[model samples]
Target: MTPLFIFLVLLTSQVLGGLNNGASSKNVGGRRQPTGGGGLDENIPVIEIRGEGAPMSSAQIRHLEEMDNGGPLDIKIEKTFVPAKCPQQAKRLDFVTFHYKVFTEDNKKVYQTYGTGPVTIQLGTGMIMPGLDKGLKGMCAEELRKVRVPYRMSRKSKSKVWKNIPNDENWLIFNIEMVEIKPYTPEIQFKFLDLNEDEQLTNKEVQDFQKKMKKEFGKTWKNEDIDNVTAAGYYIKYFDVNGDGIVTEVEWLKIMDRDEKLINDKKTKEKGRKRDPGIGWILDFDNDGIVSYKENDEAADRFDAGPTLLPMESKDEL
Candidate 1:
């Protein structure tokens, strides 16, 4: 080919490639695209293979190419343990539990744990190794994978925990099996009940949500009258301390603090998951302690599960 023609063809191809990359399309989880803000939003999930200190660029991919040799961060899915349709996608702040084992280069087992109860951590929160964080970003619950992390990509600065590992190399090969994906925050149900855009919630709004749930689910879904000493009524009684009917931002945050306490509490109170603060606690009618659920106003205990502000059925993080 003539030099002029070859140059023109190469230039045209580069322009087309740029256009294609910038085209409007929503990724199933998230991906890179331009925005008026001119910065990649970290919350938007990316399918790209990632390294410890940076996004997977040409250099990092080359590093992986030399490290694991090929095959996209060495990911291999385990279909037997996964469901027919894995419902959720692990997101940035979603809490997750997974069983994992680390192996050395010669296939020697280095570290392992969480096979029974599973280790729980919030994704993207530095609770787990960065290599696993990057590799497992959009993975599904109950799915499994084998991933490799080279020394360069495994956060070398914090490399003090290698007593059993060889002194020469500091890499990890993980055999990971995801256990569960749990919600870290509420979604559409919260917005739908907001009634006013004041960024807070009220008892009546929750009651309306209950009515909508019944309409959407069925008559048998919830059964109680508005005026009764409903489970939800008691719940609002705890946080809506002033009894003014509306819950402000500060009050709602208090509920989250209580949840964190209930979750992290190590006492014997862990026998059964206390979905609600419980029955008698709410009757403190004096605004003395904990709270309860989103009732169709039923006999409280029968329907009183714990309180979920702007309550909605749990859903996958898609």
Candidate 2:
């Protein structure tokens, strides 16, 4: 072959070799692939359900397998369900004040993992975890439900106790029990049966009213009044509903009105007695006017004098 012709042939061979190498590299990088049956793109997830006689998608099969294996796969869960007997999806208030028991995919109780408290969020307000709010919105009184909520929607920042939750996508399972649904009443009306406080009462003034009610009137008072006043004082300091250092009697009364109803209601037993009082036991259930049974170790610790070993107290003394 001529020298020039040989050089041109070599150049053509090198160009074809380079092109073949580039195609092979693209295949190795997974940039190009053959797809059959209109399969979903690899980047997007596909869901399919299978039965004895039905069609199923790849994603659905994987979802079922993951669930069977206790949710081993990373998946987002979102669903909304109303109570079976929901009277009206819009006017669901009473059922909204339910106590929920959150659970995990492994069937572990979340309350045990995190210390216990009712996931109590007022229905309409944005106070609750979003998934919880959405789950409770349409529930009726005395309904039991299980709903799944994606971690993205859960109140992560609020739950300092759930310390080790993964920051990425997660799901929450809630087992909700609709215990009771009742009317919403204000605290002042329940307290004095009067909305108009003759004057703006201070914390001490509110306390004095209770003392007067007990002493002069010779009528017994529920210890909840004292606890409400104490809590309202703290709310005034922290929340400042009206931006006053002190919560006005009107403002305080309004809070009490909202909270007091909860205290008086029959369903209040769980929340009222279980609350941590910080000080000595402040609530006297059964209208007995004294701290008795239902008080736990945490409650007894409040009464020890001068840093005593709270656990050292005798059972009788406790």
Candidate 3:
């Protein structure tokens, strides 16, 4: 071939190869196209919901009036046992017994108690203040919730123990733990309530559930009524991402296993597990496995009332 012709042919082949490589690169880079449908809002967590305020019980209204007689007070969170989601079962007060120490903003010790066993308050009954009852509404067994009730909901209680709290209407901190939840028999109808895996439930969901229960069971029924209905209603509460209510026997077992794992983690970290059969020194707050501000050194910082708030000491620090 002529030298000029050979050069042109060689250049043409090189140009074709480069073009092919460029097309391949474009194909690889364009693999994932932009999806057009409304995507999950990246800003909000999957489980964020709230509603307008619901009707307060007359008693609650009265109590709140007395508490906020001054105004709303700033509240702080002292401690929390809430998982990502809370109040899983959503039972009224089937049975609750706890020990709590009231602390001032500075964590000063104010009131402490080892009181009331199985304090049974029906759900939606207005038997207890709306805040306390509502706080316990859907909590699962052994779930601990620490919420601040504005003075309006708490200040008028007959229990003088908490009366010392300032009425400037500061938030009333409640270190609540859902100790136990016993559902009625399946024969009556078992409704499954699921509370976990989210930051918090929207107030609207709470109100909607309450309204649905009232409409179905009659307004006279309180928390217990809703609890009973929940036990029977569709699996509205205990839904998975796929929205299945009836957890298969396998699913039930999985749930149990998962809960056991969580409980085990909590026990092992907070209080060392049983060991040595009868010879090991178990981590105990005041020689008791139960942790209370009155017992654990960690509770010290929690009850300190001073100008400067001290950070809570952890087990490692202790």
Write model 2 residue lDDT over 1-318, tens digit each, in one string: 111211111223343343444443323122453333232233332233333434565446546767786855432333334455655442322224455666665666665322354333335333345565666665566666777765545644323433433323355677766655544333322233222455443455445544443443222222333343553343334212444454444554444433335445644333233321111213332322233445332332322221221112222331
Across 86-106, the per-residue lDDT of candidate 1 in tens digits comes to 778887767777887878767
Candidate 3 segments exceeding 4 Å error: 1-79, 82-88, 92-99, 115-118, 159-169, 184-318
Task: Report every candidate's CA lDDT.
Answer: 0.50, 0.41, 0.38
In model 2, which regions exceed 4 Å deviation? 1-97, 105-109, 112-117, 158-169, 185-318
Top TM-score prediction, candidate number = 1
Tens digits of per-residue lDDT, candidate 3, 130-222, equal 555556665666666666665555543333233444544344566665555555322111122212323222324434544543443223221
lDDT accuracy of residue 269 in candidate 2: 30
